[model samples]
Target: MNDTYKMMIVDDEFEIREGLNSFYWERFQFQVVGLAANGKQALDLMQRSDVDIVLTDIKMPIMDGIELSRAISVHYPHVKIVILSGYKEFSYARDALQAGVSEYLLKPVDLKHLGESMMKLKHLLDTERQSSQKLQSYENQLANSLPAARDHFFQSLLEDLLPEYHEAKEKMSLLEIEMNATYYCCAAVKIQWRDQPDGSLTDANKLAKATTIIERHLEASQCHSYTLKRKAGELAIFLNLNATTVSPRKSLSLLFDHIIVAIEGELGGRSIIGLGEVYQSLLSFPDSYKQARSIMERHIFRERSGLFQWDPADSLHMERKEYPYSVETKLLDAVLEGNSGNSTMYFQHFWDSCGLDSEHAELPLVLRYLTPLFTMLERRLDLHGASFETMANLHMPFTEYVEQFQTLSQLKIALDRLISDITLHIRKLNDVVQTTSHSAVQQVKKYIEEHSSEKITLNQMADLVYLNPSYFSIQFKKETGINFIDYLKYCRMEKAKELLRRIDLKVYEIGELVGYQDRKYFATTFKSYTKLTPLEYRQSFITY
Candidate 1:
């Protein structure tokens, strides 16, 4: 990994961008130099700074992460971007991916996961940088020109028309493409605009113009080829070569960067690029090019506009899996009815079916699939008048949250917290009715103040109000803007606070008087509500 890499953070929220800077990014091989309020400012800052990595929020003003990422991918191809997003941008993951974002992190950023992603990017940057440096050291004799013969030779090689290795060398010498390097890599670019402006130039003519512009960006000599395919295609290229010090892929990727911008800037519009890996011989050319094209095809299906590189290690394509509607409805039913136990059980079954329980579940795939469930929950919670803090808790896990869980069991534990919370809210609502009499609500409130030290229940309050527990629950919330249990707890804690004003009563006595047997638990609850322990609360003021 690069040890002295510089990083910039872009977000609409000041605290988030500042929090990223506050973390020890330097420990993860990054130096935070500039902070921008939005993507537009980030881009301007990028031009003036020597930054290597960017951590940007997806939905910034003026320019969003998608648009910013697309610009960076085309203009500063070497710079890696990591997206910081909330649930609203979950659907944009594929779009962000197309824009060449290195990673996507959910909001309430977890520094540990952020560190892991940054370090991984560091290794990538270091490798590419080292390779680029090595390529420059090879020192070409003079810029050489790639002619039509070289293009024909490459086409023959890709088509397996070339005969033997010895004959291949003869062809390389004949075409002036034999370099001193021993290794080879191939890169291919395809341009299919999402929206192309109507123009007089034919697709062939457009490809030809792009090809000519591309030629000006490539090295003239020793070992590069260029071809404009006017028939049966957009761009079908095969690179078969030896692995050596030449670093052909880096050069190709660089040329690709230039051509991408030129085409998008000059031609119709946005396009997708697929880069293939290096192989040692002609036998592997077919496989490498096919892999590159396959990756590009997937990107096209995703409707993203960015460079898609082939990873030789993983050739398996992701399968799209849908959650069963039957199981989904069962969980939703449990949630609405406030059945925490049943909801958890149904969700567990559904999660297992998603194959996310496997020991090796991919985070992005699991997150992408689970995003919808989270959005649905948040929207429902909003309709119920939950506090903002509670909603934030709901967002934590589904967003690219803490990466601490190595197993599905651990992840489930975190999810269970969210499930229980929603169920709890619904249960609170289940016990009251909004249309109940105001005097009845006041009677319940007075009873809560009088008997808060005793164990209280919604049934007891409903008995006093002469209504069903469910109706009382809704009416209580409507009249007082809080559920019965919460109102009771508030009364108990307030009474405990008032008792602390008297110096003679011990903390344990105060706890028992407040209907808590465990003094420790009492202190914990007190601290949560008042931000002070019983002793601390008592010590803060002199008892007169």
Candidate 2:
């Protein structure tokens, strides 16, 4: 792919132009984008398209090869030019060569020699393009970010602790971050140093160097990004999906790989990156950020290295923490079944079974059981509209109330209230998910209708609603009474049936318009759904 270069052939003689074009350009890793009869035509085409190399005859009616070569040399200097001359005039050859033409071929150009020159020119172009892209990437990164401002804003953004979203927007504007991206995700690199307590000066110097290398690598990443030094002592890069409007998640892995490869090869820094989930809204970025941080915290505790992506499992790392699972499971089953009558009874039983006996209760140990358990139950409840920041805020109240409870009775009361508060939040979120998920599913149905001409996938629609793809797949089926893929195919078939109503559209054309590139596959799908081939379906409709 890198070896491929675009070229143009220009000459007054059709034979010469046709002859050059006849020789397989693709064989030499070249593509002929244009063929011009005169120098003026060639120059015009060169100006319009990216013609990397131009092969032209020395004599032409409109503009002589010498004049065209000189004009190209002055204006489109990056373009390589090869002069072809039937005239034995050494002066014409010398003049063309002086105009910075790459090569001077005789009247009957040798394909062998031309191929060799093209191979060399192709290598040069590839090298130059890579260098230019790197330089541009570095310049763009430098121009967009400042240490203090970027850090403060992103730290506040990802921690999801910003006081006001409007303030965040203002800060982002001030930082020149375009808020036009469809989705965003955070990548956090947690630096874990060796046991050796190096000198402060030495550590600082290496840190600065590592950061510089990181920024250099980040610049090469083909996505809009912002960097920050997090309070957790990690370098955070917020990635904005720019190339496509589909989803950041689709390209995230590739970009993450780019970051990992660059740092490993260049920085030699001891770090593991935590890849956060994709977020749609600005407020949600903090939750995603927290997710990244939480994953990084796992890296610290597990004493593991490399890139670890955020998963719900990270929050449940205390697998060995003993708790009354039977009672907990009974409580969960009651809640999920919406047996509100038995739910509280089951929850109380679980609390009692924890061996806390109120008086001997260690608050910290109690929370370790409660925290992940609450999250586990909440997942089953399908909670939404709550950020991790809000959950973290629970820590202060939880700790304060624990201090206020001096007796077993007081501790039990506090525990009941806490449980009640958590359950209430869960129920409220469940109600919201029930109502909103229906509307969101409908919204996806409508979106599929609108984007019938383009590719539509379950993951793309899941990203649209910010739901886990598997969960959304299930919910979509439960709500609409059709599996997502089947629903999409049905939608496409419906659109195809409508398109078939048009006398101007052929069956194959209708297939393409309805997001099916393979006509045979479309026909099979259409027949499977509607019990008729596309033509038969159209004819049946025409009978109406």
The candidate that achieves the highest lDDT relative to the unseen native structure: 2
Superposed by TM-score, candidate 2 places the C-alpha of residue 80 at a distance from the truth, in angstroms, of 44
Tell me how candidate 2 scores on lDDT: 0.67
Q: Evaluate candidate 2 by giving its C-alpha RMSD to the native, one decimal.
A: 19.6
lDDT of model 2, residue 443: 91
Q: What ranges in model 1 sit over 4 Å off?
A: 1-152, 176-180, 193-198, 220-223, 228-233, 238-255, 280-284, 316-544
The whole-model lDDT of each prediction reads: 0.66, 0.67
Candidate 2 lDDT at 331 equals 76
What is the per-residue lDDT of model 1 for residues 189-236, given as tens digits with 9 covering 90 to 100?
666653455657777677777667655555342234445362333566
- Model 2, position 425: C-alpha lDDT score: 55
TM-score against truth, every candidate: 0.28, 0.31
Clash number for each model: 20, 0
Q: With candidate 2 superimposed using the best TM-score fit, by how many Å does residue 347's alpha carbon deviate from the native?
A: 31
Tens-place lDDT digits, model 2, residues 1-544: 4557789999888877888888877866788999999988987787678878898888889898899999888666678898878888878878988999888888666778777877777777788889867755764464445456667777766644543332344345334354445667787777655444544435555566657766665556545577776554477777766657545565676655665565545544467778887765555566667678778767765443477776655465433323554566567555543345567788778766665565666667676566545655545444333432353245433345456666756766765665555555545545655666787799999999898866667668878988755446556877988767667767888888877865445787677677665565577568767888888877776631
